[model samples]
Target: MNYTLHQLEIFRTIAQLQSVTKASEQLFLTQPAVSIQLKNFQDQFNLPLFEVVGRKLYITEFGEEISETAFKILEQVQSIKYKSAIFEGKIAGKLNISIVSTAKYTMPFFLSDFINANETVSLTMNVTNKMAVLRSLENNECDFAMVSTIPKKLKIERIELMKNKLYLIANRDFNSTKKKILLKDLNTNLFIFREPGSATRLAMEQYLIEHRVTIRKKMELTSNEAVKQAIIAGLGISIMPVIGIKNELQNGDLQIIDIKGLPIETNWNLIWLKSKNLSLVAKAFKNHIELKKEAIIQQHFSWFNDSN
Candidate 1:
């Protein structure tokens, strides 16, 4: 009660941006106003929260701790607001979601429908690699994370949203005489791989190790799109999610190689830290996914069901 929320908000912004000028712009206040509020906030603590060095701002250890606490407090406050709104028979709040890059193929369509149906709800989506999404879930930075491969080390609750299939893909021009290639045949072919920390890459590697199949040469690409482009350009063949290559496959730009025991099957899981309390919005989104998951798959990815 000693410090106002406005002061904490200003401080948090400054800490995050590391620039008074940028914070002021973000907060839609004058630079002098931001400086005055920051000074007053620091005065309440009776210590320097951040230090200026070489024309750049750096948060002190104490500042970092305070900033983290401020975020938790703000998050709780938002949850309280959401709870109150729900009690009044209104569904409205912000939803923070982190998704692995592979989920980008289908997540947006589902999210779009959710957002459209709930006009008052605000949503933030962070698309990144699997490891980063897991870290965000562990840090309680996001309400939910969508991933293909769940890590055993993290104690989290997960629900299978949909099935993901990884397929071997090559350029249309690549000639192969066999209808069904043996896994060992890939030993002589160059392969394009996803970068480290990618769930797709991990799955592919595990399958190869299990079958004792080894690729002759490999190139690592950072993103699914980049890997797809590399394959299209004849850089090398890659194992990619079927969802990611829908357009390319439809256009005849890429062809799926029918390797025996290919098309690694995995489930797309929606995960959250078991210890974190779920806000109303988070619970609503989870429920929404559970209720509409099958419909979503059938609509956007019907081919998957038909083929299976």
Candidate 2:
């Protein structure tokens, strides 16, 4: 009750950096000034916030708990400021979005102009697997989730963003001629795959099963980047989105493995819970996407059509 918001902010910064010196540098204050404020703040608590050990600082258990509380408090304060601005006829707030790893290449293009136009709108984007993206949406933790595999169980509304094509790919050296191979022929090669919960892996599994092709061995990776690296290293061939591998494909480091009935198609969409109310910022983002999605596709994903 006795601590000021300024002190909480200062304490959070110190706890985060673990060093009064670094916190002072980041906050543009003298080290002594930071140390004094830290001392004043620490005087209120019996437990030490952080410790200096051999030139490095460590946050204590209590420090982490208090730091988390301080973060929530700051976030709430930011929401209040944004709410006030909205009442004054402004669209200024946080826009939290979680996207599948492959959507990273696409979402930013859609976000660019909207972000530039609304300088006050803040964006928090998390690029993770489809499982985590859906989990965040299910828990209502984020404003929107950009994913290709739409969930069957969740009650959600979606705006189609772009077509997602997953192609069987490999190191350029592995397919020198890029000759089309039958699905049965691929069973001989080792395959790299995204983790089980990944939508990309699910699509690959469906395609392989539909053709009755079975592999004997596989290596699993957790992200598009890791899977792409494995493929580029010739560790194995795997299905991956073209957007994530454009540079590799363009530079001849990797190549699409030609196969009959290849390039598993999916649609990328920005989905949110149908039951959830959209925030002003979130609504603005949706509106922006609805209005400019076509232009964004033309500018950023023209290669998608060209490749087809």
Candidate 3:
């Protein structure tokens, strides 16, 4: 019956991380301090929030319900703080953003400009896979999420940021001739693929499926950087976002294969839950992105136009 916002925050962090040790590190508190707060939080409810199994923490059904409520409370509190800051005519608050790993190549530039423009604003950016980003948005854990493919099932609003063009990339030495390849020809080569649940992988799979292309030998990598490296090592070819491979493409370490029906084009979308209240800082960022999207693309992604 008696608990503070701080205790609720601790509980939420522990629940999200599923590890008290990690929660402590994220909160900048000692493990014992985090444990004490969590204990106090659970004592107030007189019920177990989580269970430990084989040294791993799992949230119970009741714990999941409570955690959802805790998130709503925290969001409302933040909304109130943002409203106060608005009345004071100051744009300030923490902006939590979740970005799919592939967007890491371009999102940072926009975020840097936003941060530089608003000195009072703080930021927490979580770079993760597409599924994780969607989950973050669904759980109200982040103010915005940037991804290539927008899920049809989630009740969220999205704005197109730019084009996401994925291309088949191979080691420069693989083919010395500047000859375009056919999509059907790709099945013969080993293909390096992004991990399952990745937007890039999903896009690639959809395209291949539609074209009736099946890769018999494939290597799955968890990160774009790893996939690029693996391709450079001649492990296989991969379909990667052009934004993430611009540097390598320019350096001639990797070459975008001129393939018939290549460069799967998708839009980069900025998404947020429709029901969640946006903080002042979050609103500012949304505006900033809209206003500066074209200029940002021109500055950092001009190559896109030239390549296309």
Candidate 4:
């Protein structure tokens, strides 16, 4: 079979995702291009690789074996590239990080300098909720994780990068006749929340418990962007990291509510399992963050002072 490496890579992605649309999205290729390439690859093999039943794609038994082979081949090819780079004495390899979704708003600033300095290093950042990110870290699926809430169950080493400040936010049209808004005053059902297992949600819940805050009405959204939009739509107020809502605040679409106890703060942290051995690339990346994070913060996040 005269199959190209591109065809092998595309086949691996399709096998893993089980959908042409999803594979195309992940590969940043058009759906039709993915479909055509898939057909061309399948034409080389006599046995069917995949089948569609009830509008769902299913890999054939032989297809599963081929997919595994494809995965190993791609992995070996990548290893060869990394070995070549190492022989040249270059700081090169992949850096995989699992991060709480909100960290997507700020962690790039902390990573920018190192990433720019090491042009050959590949970065894969998986942004998800805190629980999922922690799970990834616990499974050793990533080199590091960026989070605000430190986990108790893991023995980890961490560098505190910056402060994550969460404030009670409302749409600009939200009524605020009183100068001093008490937690008890927000006793209505007009509260919105991030989904449970979110670090921000946990922080909000902790503050609510401390102040005995209660809301008669509440709804849940799974992402920072969603919660921000819900608030902008005047659906309800929510506690969100200031970093995630900067543009909205600047645009006057949202306003911060200064209640008796507000702006719950936590340190943004980069953490890794203490027991895991670090690769040269991971160690170099860690060193870069530890050394230059302060300058990066000061340069990119100076507006944080005014965001408050």
Number of the top-ranking candidate, with TM-score as the measure: 4
Candidate 4 residues 205-302, lDDT tens each? 88898888876898999999999998999899988899988788889999988887678878989999999899898999999998888888888888
- Per-residue lDDT over 273-296 for candidate 1, one digit per residue giving the tens place of the 0 to 100 score: 888799877888888888898888
Across 1-308, the per-residue lDDT of candidate 2 in tens digits comes to 48777778888998887778889998999989888887888888999888888988898999899889988998898888877877888889988999988888899999999999887788999999888999999999999999998899999999998899988898978854636677777877898888978889899888888888889888998988899888888899998888888889899999887787778888999999999899878999999999999998998889996786
Candidate 1 residue spans exceeding 4 A from truth: 1-88
Kindly list the per-residue Cα lDDT of model 3 for residues 187-252, writing each as its tens digit: 788988888889989988887898888888988999999999999889989888888887788889
Please list the C-alpha lDDT of all candidates, in the order they appear: 0.86, 0.87, 0.87, 0.89
Candidate 3 displacement at residue 249 in angstroms: 1.0
Cα distance off (Å), candidate 3, residue 76? 16
Ten contiguous residues with the weakest lDDT in model 4: 299-308
Which residue pairs overlap in candidate 2's backbone?
A: none
Better of 3 and 4 by lDDT: 4
**TM-score between candidate 2 and the true structure:** 0.84
lDDT score, candidate 4, position 189: 41
Question: Ten-residue segment with the worst summed lDDT in candidate 2?
Answer: 175-184
* lDDT over C-alpha atoms for residue 39 of model 4: 97
Which residue segments of model 4 deviate by more than 4 Å?
53-56
